[model samples]
Target: MVQTYTSPIRVYKTPFEFVMAAYEKRFPTCKMIPIFVGSEITSEITSEDKAVTVIERRCKLNVDAPYLLRKIAGVEFVYFIQKNTLDRRRRTLVIEAWNESFASRLVIRETCKYSVHPDNDDWTCFEQDAHLEIKSFFGFENAVEKLAIKQYMANIVKGKEVIDYYIQELIDEGVTHIPRFVPTGITEDSALDQSGIEDEITLSSLNHMALGATASSMTMDKRIHRDSLYKLDADYIHRCLGDLDPVEESRIVELKQWLQEHHKEKIPSDAHLLRFLRARGFNVEKGREMLCRSLIWRKQHQIDRLLKSWHPPDVLKTFFPGGWMDGYDDGGRPVFVLRLGNLDVKGVLRSIGVDGMLKLAITICEEGLVKCEEATRVQQRPVSYWACIFDLEGLSMRHLWRPGLKVLYRIIEVFEANYPETMGRVFLVRCPRVFPILWTLVSPFIDENTRKKFIIYGGEDHQQPEGGLTEYLDGKSIPKFLGGDAECGFPEGGIIPRSHYLPDDLAEMESGIDSISINSESLYQSVSLVKDSYHEVPVIVHDAGTVITYDFDVCKGDCIFTVLFTTSAVKIPSSTPPASPALQTSISVIHPDLKLKEVIRPIPCSDGSSEQGTHVADKAGTYILQWKGVDPTASTAVHSQFSFDFGLTSPPKCKVMYHYDILTQDEFRGSLSSVQSFSSLSMA
Candidate 1:
């Protein structure tokens, strides 16, 4: 296989003629490069007016390889043929080199060019391309390829340093500039037109120097002009995108070019493309696929306008305990603090529902992107990711509420899919023992690379002098609650008041879960119940000893949930039909004469909690799961007709989202704790 490498354009703060002088200094032999043994000119040519020159040379270099391989090759050095073409009139130089010693066994070709910068004529630009193919190397092909890549990368970095050293040396020796070439019989205006430069005509040789020519500055400039979209700067990559290896750099260029060609209307920023590439381990195909899907999602959701158009609801503003810190971390990344211990997860879920919470989380991510761009400008460096500190001091089992966790899992999926590599670090301070249980449940859903970024601390470990927040954040920026002086303005969240919760009807509408029908987009179904009236769906079991599992959340009001089993077929009412055939095989309506054997006694359920349980069938029969809405103020069930007497105005309604699954005894694997009352099924 042939391996190729292409480097970003490197700019030098010097005129083309002055840069050419520095290039000439590297010929014959130079001690700066130890492997560069020597070079002898094999051919040379010059134009009549000294405006163009061409030279060919045979160069020798010691192979930087293992001793065993060197012994096997039985040679002290290798030879390469190099050709240089200089056109002073155009102010450009091209160098081509290829290995001569291993012509049959190995093929190495390199091309480099130096020309005037398009944006700034006073500055010079250099670019390089190379290809290496090792057909055979005595069964050490892989080792040889690795060594070649390592050596090539090292040399590429050193090449710029060598030029800078020579340029400085010339400056120290008081040689500031070299005049551009003039063709024979050319007037002054024509010469200026041909070269696009004004130079003193006196200094034709290196010995004679012209002090009037503008002196080139030695300091490096790291910024690239926005207009030069086709070219990438090496310094800009180093400063803004972090250090990338040669192959990774190639991948970025390739992917960027692909996007420009295919999606020219809107190309993502380099940092965004890089995030996807990193997420996919630099595999261009996988990265492209992931990025394309995310782009479509963004368009479909109108994510670009989210920062300006979307605002957090009043509930999130008042009860959500997460916010971006006013200050940045030591690495200049924006810090976001999520006070999980102070968060009332169950309350928030009950108040807003899953769809509302998802929208809020996405809004936060969009805000993070904006802050990241601002930080990059303010800090004058790359700030593509943000840091998060999760304060888990008061975390408890209530946070493990199944419904709330479902919302949490959904948020993680969206973040991983659309916002990869946006999390630079995660600090989980003051984590309690129960935190691991939570982590175990959610960590599997997180990407391995992302999970590696988590930094957890228990008790007072985060306040310790070593391996603490201080190591990553400034002392003055640490929150006061974490043993620091800074005041945290994020909400100190508590349980939300039930009065603030939206009505059951409004909540269902906002969540897009129509209680009247079975939604194919969602696995769970929702239903609304009025006071005294009960809802029943019968499950037909064909196999005995099958396990039936049910999970549900009461989104509004209060209710009692019970399970019933009877060998007799339950009568169906024409007024209400089963929503879907999968879970609700048959339906039953509330009737005065109806009586069924109760398997699981009525268990009270209310807003802000999730209930889950499993029951094993002793014999094949029809089992019904029933929900009866009860008055919030009453201990005894009220008859359906007089339910409004307890309430002054209107009848109260309860809303629930539920799901059920049946598995054979041998295939049942339950995640939650089993019900201890499974053996206490009573027939009444």
Candidate 2:
């Protein structure tokens, strides 16, 4: 595979002539770049007027590769053929180089240019680009390619610093200025002798040049702030987007430029784009796809207007245990506190369902963005993220309710996809024994970079004077509930009232107030089963290695769930066929002489419980998921506290909401059991 890299244009705040003189001193070898072994000029030429020069050299570089690979390739130092063309008349220099070792198996080419800045004659601009392709590398093609690019980018990052170091050396040596070349029909040596003298300049001309440079810089800064954005200025990037390496800076500039060309009217802020880039590890293609999908979601949901048009339901405002505080963190970031342990996840889900919970989470994310901007303005620094405190004092098994977890997973997906890197820090304080269960299920989905921001405290140690919340937050900002004197303005959440549970009809009506009901377009479907009847869904499988996964919540009464496959020549309908006599009674329509193939043995699902599992199809056939309404009295476990608030009387209908997705063997990355402890369970 061939890879390419392009660097953003870098400006040197020095004259072109002076920069070139410092650049020339870097030839042969330099201490700043130890990997650059040496170079030997093979050819050299100069025009009669000394206005142009060309040189060719063979350069040797120490390869930074594993010893085994180096031995296999039989080389320690790689060689490159470099050609340089300098035009003094035009104040430009172009350098091109290509690898000389393993030319047939690998290719590495680079081009670098230095020229006078377009707007200012006194300053120089530098740009570089490179291409690398590894056709074969002794059965280590991918490893070699990665190593080559890593080394290449490292050199590029160091190139400017090397030049600056040499420039400072020249300054300390009293070689501050070098005369620009003029066509005088004189030899280069004669011009070099007079280069020591500074050119005479009038005070008026000096002032005019300084003022012009300043004005041009100010104009560029204003352009960056204006809607009609142009190039990314180094100062502007550092001031607004934080520090980034040369490669990262190039990616941001490249992605931003692409957006400006393709999405001119609705270009997101650089900070927004940066979050997506960071999420995808700066892979431009991946970042582009993620950003475009998020943009489409925003447009479809009208999320851009959510802050102004949407209002939280009274139930949420009173029962939700999370809100932004008036105080900032030690680093000047906005702070948000969530009493997650005190939250009634089951109550909230019953009150608003999955979609309402998703809307609330997304709204908080949007609000965090606004607060970050405000903090940035007020703190006079780049505040792109906010700190969060999760007080898990009363956390328990109820917080791990499957439906609630499902909602959390969905919200995490949305946040990771669209709002990456927005968390500056997370303090998980007073985490109880059950906290690991919740963390185990969600941590895999969190980006590793974001996970590193979390600070976990297992008990009341967070109230300590050292190595605690006080280390990251102001003392006065600490809530009184956490042993502080300050009064936390957010609600003190407790068990939500049973009266707050909204029926389906009422929840739907309330959701209309905000266009954020995910269930309205949910992929999952719900079914009501009467006693002695079954609900079935048929899925067609064409490939043998396909994986079928099922997740369902038993919302009402007890039932038996089973997965089966058919080998007989019976036709399967695309949609869910009506509960037939064979499916309801026998679990299969295969011949009586032939044995039924049961992929998953029937598992008893009790009231208010959830189950999820996966099966690999052994053959291409019709796979059916059948749920049969069972007598709740048959299962002694159903009579226990696990039934939650359900009464003893048999309900007329048992409800189940389910969703299924198929993945090819290659796409099935992991087993949920590895991350989640529950194979199947019900909680009272």
Error of 2 at 468 (Å): 2.7
Worst 10 residues of 2 by lDDT: 675-684
- 54-171, model 1: which lDDT tens digit per residue? 9999999987888998888888898999999998888899999999986888899999999998879799999888899999988888998998888788778889999999999999
Spell out the clash pairs found in candidate 1: none
lDDT of 2 by residue, 206-313 (tens): 545766755755764455455235357665677778888767877887788788767746888888988899889899899989999889889988889988887888
Give TM-scores for every candidate, taking all chains together and pairing residue i with residue i: 0.77, 0.64
What number of backbone clashes does candidate 1 have, counting pairs of residues 3 or more apart or in separate chains? 0
What root-mean-square deviation over C-alphas does model 2 reach?
Answer: 11.3
